[model samples]
Target: MSAPDPLHDLGVRADADGGLLRLWSEHATAVELVVFAADDLDWAIDRVAAERDEHGVWRARSARLVPGAHYGVRVDGPAGPAHAFNPVHTLLDPYATGLARADDGSWRGVALAPLDAPADRVYEAAARPPAPRIPLDRTVVYEAHVRGFSRRNPAVPAELRGTYAGLAHDASIEHLTRLGVTTVELLPVHAFVSEERLVRQGRPNYWGYNTLAFFAPHAPYATTDAQAAGPAAVRDEFAAMVDGLHRAGLEVVLDVVYNHTAEEGRHGPTFSFRGIDNAGYYRHGVDGEYFDTTGCGNTLDFGGEPARRLVLDSMRYWAGEVGVDGFRLDLAATLGRDEDGGFDAEHPLLRAMLDDPVIGATKLIAEPWDVGPGGWQTGNFPAGFTEWNDRYRDRMRDFWLSDLRRERETGSAGSGIGRFATRLAGSANTFAQERGPLASLNFITAHDGFTLADLTAYDVKHNEGNGEDNRDGTDANRSYNHGVEGRTDDPEILAARRRSIRNLLGTLLLSAGVPMLTAGDEVGRSQAGNNNAYCHDSELTWLDWSWGEDARRLLATARHLIRLRAENPALRPVRYGVFGETTPSATQMDWYNADGATMTIDDWNSPAERTLQYLAASTPETEGPNRILLVVHAHEAPTEVVLPAHDGVDRYVLLWDSAAESPDADDAPGAPASETRPAESRPGERVGVAAQSMRLYRAEGAR
Candidate 1:
């Protein structure tokens, strides 16, 4: 077998006696470990020359390099087309667990003391009460920014607001639990800094995608006390937060950025990777120009051994040492690119991640695309990975929003219920048979796009506040403002908008794939029509807990929809069904038109025919047999639909109405039990459906 990998343990490690520093550089002629004075970071107290081993790893040791010592590495290497090496440049360790900004505006690594107990024991103790390990079919993910999530919550302490502790506060947990989401997917928490361009423009990179350090918790996100107490304290606070969330039965998922670093283009700052070994760390063209895949200026060379080791190590640290239950990989397509810059389904790094015992147990999600050539790889990831389904988001938006706009302006919807129906049943055409519907992560809105309320209130993006002259966000919003754009006092317009919210929410929760809800969508939050609000950190991005009557109604409707999804097995399927055969955990679907007969090919593809009755019966392996009937009418005008008659069904009970202001008049708990009047209806009976509405009914078989 080949020699063991020397890149392992490639950062500062403290022990009872002293500390050891390991740096990896294939081309370095000389590497030195420079120790700085704690009082004056710019003053180097001592420098020890590191010896290079056969495996290209430079190693050094010192008693002065003990815990809390500030240090950096200086490497001298031959300069060439693919390299940008400077002997005097002090580079931060790539695997630095703690970092400190020096007085000269540079960075230094801080050696952290050994924990009171073993790292695994500490993490396990902190993660007491444990994650509920909610099944993928039963999981509902709520994506939120850690700072924006509890920043404005009046119940959270003022000092703790906008911090990790704030998110673990009782008020925040209560809101999430009451909303019925099982997991909270947080935006990037890796230590990041504002981009050079944004810093020059007096703005900040609010989304935290520009990762500066992979193994460190962002110090600024902690309370002032924690920040002042240093990196160890910051880490403790983060651990406490995870423990609190786990105790409350809510899982935490982190949005991880590994495709690119904070270091931008060729002329960008030489902080860590660039100063150490540019050629070995980053992707570059033969002519020495950076191959910027991901559109973030520089892409990490995943094909390189050292780079792959770094990513795998960081993931292991986060999953085992920190208590996160899952990860959402940003710009994941870049991670699968080979040395030739071509996409590979079984890339070494990707396979390593799936096979690694430590990282493989946790949930893995991929954004599945980047800005590079041939970057859209949706439904093309490995078996255990779930990918964000942009197709689902687009088609749902088109059917409900853009189609409505076309119907009013051109007297045609421009599409039919066929495409929408396929998506509702989990986009079988998109994902593979073995992977099934769970491979598709469905969402109508996310942190990078327009809120659900804005989708029904704005036809075009109003991004003037983004300082790009309304050109910063995507123009293909697929949104409609009913009859008017922006805010309007017209009661009819307001009513239609509210109904649209209910319809979209219902579609997301009742679909066959995993649903991800943007944090504030349940309360009808809007970004003032700004589809891209990545730069804003003020009240514009925070979740406003205070709500009006309409918003409250929307929140109530969301809770009811989630409950319905939990109670109905026909809505969430683990596998696709085969015709004339039963499959465990699969849904057998039937389609019909307004006349109650089996749907014709014309009904599926005709744009003018936008109404359909969907009947689904679940062949559950563990749960009870269940069935549901969904009536969809997307036309601008009302339609009368005749319920379809099936052999085993006798009555249809009304479960939910998207057209109603509330789920039920009295809002009684548990499946609208009292509203069973329209509940008991014989097949072939005609029901009046409002314009652009969805009606759900529970089918009761003969008993």
Candidate 2:
């Protein structure tokens, strides 16, 4: 047929005797393979010339390319506006399965030992737990930083603290299992380096978005013993960590930054991608200037075949080799940009991500936007991918925090209850009917924003420590400090803040979509209003193990909410219900005003209409028939709501109450499986709903 694809078997294909190294650099004229001395990376042991094929792939065979060998490639090419091939600068293989840093801080491709597939599948209780392929509809993501998660936890061993092993420790696993989260979405674990600006400022890139190498696990995240043992050992430790999480039935989802590399802006550094093929790897104008949609300086040109393949290969490796269950593509809009420099839902790389069997079979989630034009693609991603619902986040924050503040200032909130109700019922107007509610990965707080507690205590971002003088984070933070800024001794103020947090959490779990909880939010963790705490790897970012009475109550509330979500099928719908036709696996919704009557247009739009009731009954496909009635009150004043009357429904059992201090409160429901039962209510029952709070009830009946 046609010429064989040179991209096939890229990276090192090694065995004991020797191996072949294939690298793609379209602009390079001469590519040379340099093998460094195993003991001393500075010393070169072998230099071999590579021959380029028609596809611009340079190939070289070396016995030195076996397991544990250290090597770098030196490329020389024509000096042009688009080309920056440096013969002196040693560049890492784009397809490197591993990476290592030299004493002088230069990086080389690590030739890690091949993993044993047979051994990996053997699950002798805890040896290598199989991946828990939980369905997307049932997935509950708990986003956490690998290092920060257990760094400050006293229960984790000192030696293992802040490492991948630390996150996989038994104590760490127990905490997640107890909290009832199904998936652990860790921040970028990809081998990353500090941005040149942060490095100069003597701060670290704590979030790991500045990816150095996509395929290699961050060596620093491995234990000291694993780090010294080299990249292969680091990978083993990472795999073990995944296995441990799997043992606890927790899926590991990595926040992967494939949109850009650690090689920042034009003046930044020449580590790997730049030295080899700057013109080809990065998106550039006709004059060779970079187009940075990622906000990370150099955006990896997924428009190119080689660059697109790079991402596919990385996914295959991480999913197939290291055992990651899913990936939350960071600034994913960059990945969808085509050769024409416009984002397309069906962009080749994006399509390949879902079409490729190895990656497509696993869960795929997208952050869905970047800093590029038309970048706010909130619900624009394809059906198979779940997008981080920023709209949901903003609306929830606004309804509870900002709207309440507006009510206090002008006696009227800017918005009515209509939009909030839409978000709470999974934003059918935002996501497509085919994708349904699950496509909306709803969250009130993520790693990038203020914690749940901070959202109610800070009116403005306090990010002076980020070195940008409070100019780094988003100013459009829909947050409100109640009566006073920061912490206060006012019990009423504190009580109000706690009630708001509970309301936000209740809305998130009872909503008709997959929910992602920021790791420390359940326990009211605060960064003291530092919304952009991306630089400091200190106590401000870590998940603290210790908690006071308030934090413990919040934790119990979160657990109960999660348990309620798992038990009630109506709360999480797989399909958006059609008005008249009953869609299988969908939720039939009925909206009611505070008077228990069908909500009129005025009732939905009026600023005074702060009270609404949502009744969702699931048209079950796999699960048994289920229905939930949620009462929402956003006004500062306490109000009474009449429970909506439904046909053949006897009474509603109070499953949860935001006004209740904790889930164990007499009126509120605890876990579904718990022996303690909740209070019951009849149709048209007038219930007292607290200021800015919600009450969830199970509609018990056989219609």
Candidate 3:
């Protein structure tokens, strides 16, 4: 109300007016902005009664909104779940970039006028600044939640554990670096509101997917020092985390949920955007009713100009202000829908992301589909973007799990060598040549589903702890428990599971496209059967640093596989070459069966043939210095297959064998197993693959 008011320094800035604050409470009979002294949290100097407009908006102009000032909004009105307006309750401003929680869990908003805080200066002034933007071609993405990644680590300090600074600690970085992923794809870190049910149960949304403020980092993940610094401090800490990751040469990609907000239907809380402009921001039914796309209450309507601006502005803020290297847009198809409800690949929001100069270099990946009608847009995204390849997930699962189960139980294999070869070579059939192989973001496991370990250790999803009566999580998991369900001490069963993990990892790393590995998958982390650990914040979600012998072995195997992927150009193909003929700069991938002959159509559609040999030779013009051959055997029984002995190649080398207790040293490819394959061999003379495993070979001299 007077000169030097923190509100003047902290409030929103406008060209004409110095600072401004707006309240979005339609049911409130009265609303007042209460500004408090910085040092004394309990006392307030004055209250500014809001001026309501024709649209029921309440706003006040003042220069007192500066950093360090404490404030809250006191609204007088109705109270209940559907009608949440308590005049006695002094609510924290939902738009407060900074927050300080009181003893009672209520927050004191930061002083307002400082829109141009110190944190904002550092972000806008910094140039290139060494942020790691790993190319999708050579990327091995490790998906994780910031808090869950460090919560269980003993090496990280107790107080900092599960916080943003905690994740940037050397202990966590060392673990990820040792595991060998180029990018750490973090789950949603945007500010979010916990569901009332979760709060009552004393549980928080561990995944943080229900975003409340797209521009603000969730304050809980910040350290005490950061939290005390207010919103500016939280922003600085987040930027510092990105700086640390970039210094370590690891890219930071975010799993963004722009499809929906924390607002749950019409009954949800009045938080941020929903309270700011509900009717204009959210998509609704024909009669200006409820939103139906997200099933999670409400979906953001990208159909409108103002909504599109909000989305584009948020994206730019994260990419430029927060300094994220890339983004994986959740339920992206929902963002492409028009007012008439038709999805457009060239939607204005999507186009702006592709063309925005400030953030154009940032990697753009789409979850590709939504729960809406005509939502399955798999390979339909425009060029310059990548998509999560769910088809590849199912196919790979069927190849190693379901197919191997059929082989063991019925003494007959399922599926073919040809289709398996396509997945290995980037699933060109699914993505066109123009969009190229990078169009596919391939993965066998994701955060929403089972880990690679569980994919082979559990046949059915065990999600009893989710409190959803097992109705939650996906049932079409395409998994195989491999002889025994859950944990088992049986030596044979344990050995099979290990091999299966290696096989899956091998397939993922060896496949052409951008590969995303779920956090803890490298070390064989399990959710104890809970596929959707969205709410459980304990060990169910944390990455366990202390691992057993099998987990350690899997970690080593994963590292070796990632190194192999990085070194081999053939494995990270950006373009889809001619399948039947040679194409420049692209390797011609060939397929064969146990009988040592080219695969036919019958071999593919048949649910009886599970073994395949994959041969890839670079085109003569663009062969460069890398060439290799990879073979896969998806069977329970030991099978001896002859090498092709192509006219040019005389011998081959063994680079890796998933069946081996450990990865074997390099060996020539085409030569007989007894001759060139000189690594530790099993009792049998044939190249034996413990059921549900894969192996890689490199071709040498020409015959």
In model 1, the runs with Cα more than 4 Å from the true position are 1-3, 113-127, 666-671, 674-678
Worst 10 residues of 2 by lDDT: 117-126
lDDT, model 2: 0.88
lDDT scores of the candidates, listed in order: 0.88, 0.88, 0.74
How well does candidate 1 score on lDDT at residue 686?
92
Q: How far off is residue 252 in model 3, in Å?
A: 0.5
For candidate 1, the TM-score is: 0.96
Per-residue lDDT for 1-703 in model 2, tens only? 8977768888888865687888888888999998999889989988889999988899998988887789999999988777787798888887777887779888889877556623333222234667889987788999999999999999999999999999999989999999999999989998889988898899999999988888888888899988887787788888888988998999999999999888888777888888888888999987777998988788989889989999999999999878899999999999999997899999999899899998998889999999998888889999789999999999998898899899899988888999998998889999988889999999999999799999999999999999998889888889988989999999999999999999989888888888999989999999999999999899999888889999999999999898889988888888888889979988899999998999999998887788999999986788888889989888878899889999867899988889889988655554343757667889988988888888888998854
- TM-score per prediction, in order, is 0.96, 0.97, 0.86
What's the true lDDT of residue 202 in model 2? 99
Whole-structure CA lDDT of model 1 = 0.88
Stronger candidate by TM-score (2 vs 3): 2
